[model samples]
Target chain A: MTVIRAALLGFGTVGQGVYEAIKTHQKRLQERLGKKVEIAGVLIRDLRKQRSLPKHILVTDNIEDILAIDDLDIIFEAIVGNEPCYTYLNQAIEKGCHIITANKAMFAQFGTKLLEKAKQHRVQVGFEATTAGGVPIIRTIEQLLQVNKIEKVEAILNGTSNFILSEMRKNKLSFPDALQLAQERGYAEADPTNDIEGIDAFYKLMILSELIYGGQPEWRTVEKQGIRTLTSEKVQLAEQKQKRYKQIASLTKKDGKVLASVKPILVNKAHPLYHVEDVDNAIKLETSLIGTFTLQGPGAGKLPTASAMVEDFIYVLEKDKSIKQQGEVVYS
Target chain B: MTVIRAALLGFGTVGQGVYEAIKTHQKRLQERLGKKVEIAGVLIRDLRKQRSLPKHILVTDNIEDILAIDDLDIIFEAIVGNEPCYTYLNQAIEKGCHIITANKAMFAQFGTKLLEKAKQHRVQVGFEATTAGGVPIIRTIEQLLQVNKIEKVEAILNGTSNFILSEMRKNKLSFPDALQLAQERGYAEADPTNDIEGIDAFYKLMILSELIYGGQPEWRTVEKQGIRTLTSEKVQLAEQKQKRYKQIASLTKKDGKVLASVKPILVNKAHPLYHVEDVDNAIKLETSLIGTFTLQGPGAGKLPTASAMVEDFIYVLEKDKSIKQQGEVVYS
Candidate 1:
């Protein structure tokens, strides 16, 4: 039996979710993994924030304190953007510790470097939560790599955008009103630029493209078209035509060049992704082996994203066990 | 680099496709797996039958000839039904050889026994080809098992039944005419009692149930209904209500009791599986962690099913590598 000492970086929505998952499913995870998972510390912005966690759990604001702890086996990070999370993960990887992150922007921009560094140190960098949360899309892609050639990736990746579009259709509301409702419900961020302008989905698409194709998806080459121009008038017109409008994020590799775009598309009954509603995310992979596979699930929430992290935790544990036994060279 | 020596148990459609995949994608697979794969020999029922294969590959009618080859690491069995195939695979497991199979009925009936025997011998047994063709459904379940308790499964499993049902709807054909079309198109067998009567889907569901619930799904307890009773009139009646007839195989755990069934169901455009037409298969998984996930793909064909088996081959190879390194005990 082994005891895994872990830390939570950026105690926000995703961080709290991870801590709660660890607490709720501790027995089951331990039974399945034959190990005890101990949350060594939590890093948050405010020391006075009274989070509802175990009374004895360590809550710290110092990055130096976490770096000084030599016994840390893994780091679960869900910070908003790239900066400090990337830096913290880099340190953890250099220390030969595993890291799981839900930060899509960090992976999209700097995944190659992080993966290379992790491979060099023989530690896993898991980002299942970075894509369609808790849907197992990343691991499915990993298995598909064993015996398939992927052709196209068409997905509904942004839940906030989808929720707004769904509200516009359901309540006959304007795009602005829908966006306001989404923000009120905490689905959309305060700025709402990333969600409404398709930047969030674009980051997720780049990350997925990096995994599918072994290269970076430069943002400049992608076509960004958000749902800002869409209105209830168009939704009514689409309904008259027996179709619905969906915020679609798609990447197709044609003649060795990737055509990446995020836009709202009209879908009819014939389309498999037509039924994906509200905050659900759906990804359709067209491959040479499987023909076409579509996975639809709840995009992301506190527990779902954290569940994805725990999924990564189990994945890294199993991988580390294998690598330690064989002393085999790691591959990203 | 590692070299995998494998043998074919039946040189039929799936077997021929496996050989063709090995031939067509040899370089690509070698690059991906970092290994060399060689088809050492093939087992056939009749030596008199003419087969179009490369000159140096061995073909023998006797199963004993394969067992005599001591260096064989894995067996790829595609023989129909549960007879000599079961016996041959059992022997291979006893010899500590890994096995990959696409035989659904055999697995549905005797998977637990074979998996138990494999565990006793410290060998891997893979059956990704047993259900959902090349969609990677089984592997996805393996990953989801890390963090979720699966609650329910609803799937469209039988491609031939779906094809016939779709043909009836599209062409206004009678059931007999649709079945004839399916048989002519090679979607259904000459004696397609299994496909039309829903036994094929029943077997697939049993296999999936075993994977999800970790227990044997006794066939007698299952509620089976077929597309045999439905007529074109009923199809048209359902069509008027914007609903399509689908051959759905489902298993739900209600109040801790497992309810299993396969039958024709009416699905409207809002249902995720509504657009899964032709030979496509879709499985919707409801779990405690991820909410709902639906996967749609080409159910099975020669190359697709062969791709699934090759996927299993790769899976078992990686698993065997890990086990050999750790010297760990195997489990079903």
Candidate 2:
């Protein structure tokens, strides 16, 4: 069987999930691609740590080890930081390998540059997991842009913040208590600074803005206010009036300038974003053609994020096949 | 400039909308495809009728006039019926021209046959507008199927029936009164048999079923019940219980069999379809990888349907370009 050799840049939650998904759905992947997807190497922080990977696959702490793999077809990067992930992806692209990443922070900062490098190298870059996990918002936006102009985009891009706000409103709990519950459920990190301080949503919003408008607002000028100071009383009062408080990341182009913001807004019942609660994320796009289009699903998770990457991998393979073959293509 | 010669099979609402969309987005289309889209011919029922088309375009009552167009790359079919539309599409496919259609009734019956013929002729058939007009459910499903198995699909596929049901509950109107209001608002046709009797939703459901499962229930075996018999009192009672009556078309795979139905189902507030009101349509897909993903939008409108067809046309062009070009491809 023809095998596409791939490497993983991190063995964290998303990386492990991607590996497991490839294992569990190997048959389906083979059936769709007509080729086997093999994980040739994995780059981890600690080589001493035990992993349940097959013995034939190489696990290393050095990025150079994975980059040295012969005929490496793709790279899946799930590292948390912005420095090495960006540099590593550039290196992979230089080696003519398609790359898929879940590193939102790194992507938000250097996504446009990375895309240009990938373009110049004639390799694909899949970042669907960088914005909204499992919702396919990136792909949806691309398809919508083919025939329609997106006038406005309002979205709940951070699952942790949305979950915290929803818990506060639904359980009438204080912000701290709701955040504690979120941590207990693994929705929020130990520090929770990035998620609760609106920085996470800001990154995702910038990613979306760049995709839709082909540019983004100046980072410091983009207003971002998180939900740490919102009181339980305010949430309850809003609920009494049939309104809900949600963390909304919005982008609108006016006067040929893209205005972007990430803040907590009280939404009415008629608003599509009002019902989007808990760990679920939703995006409402007001387009030039379709009046209002909404898509909602799990914003972030091991499987959902991994599923996005796997789907991107399959898409890259299929698109690559179309360029190589002259006969009928099932999807194209 | 390189040009793609095209034709419109019907000049009804959807057909006219497609023409208008092409004209309005001509610049963007040319920018994306690097090819000007030219409407070389149009097949209409009345040859002498006034059409708001350019003088350079040919409008005809006969199909042969359209088939004779030189270098025809695509055909956009929006005709209402099953027989002549199917035959015309088959003929177009035989000419090795790509086709996009919004004819749900015809597609629900002969979609598989048409797809097979298109495959044989190496022509693409796009039926994105056949299921949920602006929701892009068909394309969403196709993308999801790449890495996930769809376990269940529940959707509001008809706007007229949903409008009547929403009005009946919201205004306490009788079924006939609500339907009359829908007709006045141009949401329903004068002959409301297909919409009110659930046949329209059934056809769309069948189309979705065929897309997902590659087969559908025997037509007679599918249980379909419309909202015509739903009483205002019942709707009010359900509303009091925080529920809504929606014309739901649902499909589930169990024990390796695909069970399908279209009916007026009372949905609780927690149900995704509960908040879908008026002419809005929503589809909830329960997939193996993504859990429950929902998309909501305008179910039917001139601009929305036309937007879908135009998007499909762009997709076909992009895919075809990838097959022909050996160098870099933007979307692929």
Q: Pick the candidate with the highest DockQ.
A: 1
**What is candidate 2's TM-score for chain B alone?**
0.96
lDDT at residue B29 of model 1 (Cα atoms): 78
Where model 2 places Cα greater than 4 Å from the true spot, the runs are A322-332, B323-332
Q: lDDT (0-100) at residue A190 of candidate 1? A: 85
TM-score attained by model 2? 0.97
lDDT of 1 by residue, A1-332 (tens): 37888988988888988988888889989998888999988888898988776765677788778766658889998887788778888988988778998999888988889999999998998899999887778888887867788898889999999998888887889998998999899999889989888888998899888888876556797888889999799998897898988889998787787789999899996786777888889998888866777888878998889999999999888988887766543321
Task: Please state the CAPRI-style docking class of candidate 2.
Answer: medium
For model 1, how does the per-residue alpha-carbon lDDT over B1-332 read when each residue is reduced to its tens digit?
Answer: 37778899999889998988887778877886687888888999989999886776678988888877758899999899899789999999987689999999999999989999999998999999999887778888877877888888889999999998888887888999999999999999889999988899999898988888876556798878899888999998888898999999999777767789999999886777777888889898888877888888888988788889888888788888887766542221
Residue-by-residue lDDT tens digits, candidate 2, B78-105: 8888878888998999998999999999
TM-score of structure candidate 1: 0.95
* Shift in Å, residue B171, candidate 2: 1.5
> Each candidate's chain A: what TM-score?
0.96, 0.96
Residue A152 Cα positional deviation in candidate 2, in Å, after optimal superposition:
0.2
Work out the iRMS of candidate 1: 2.8
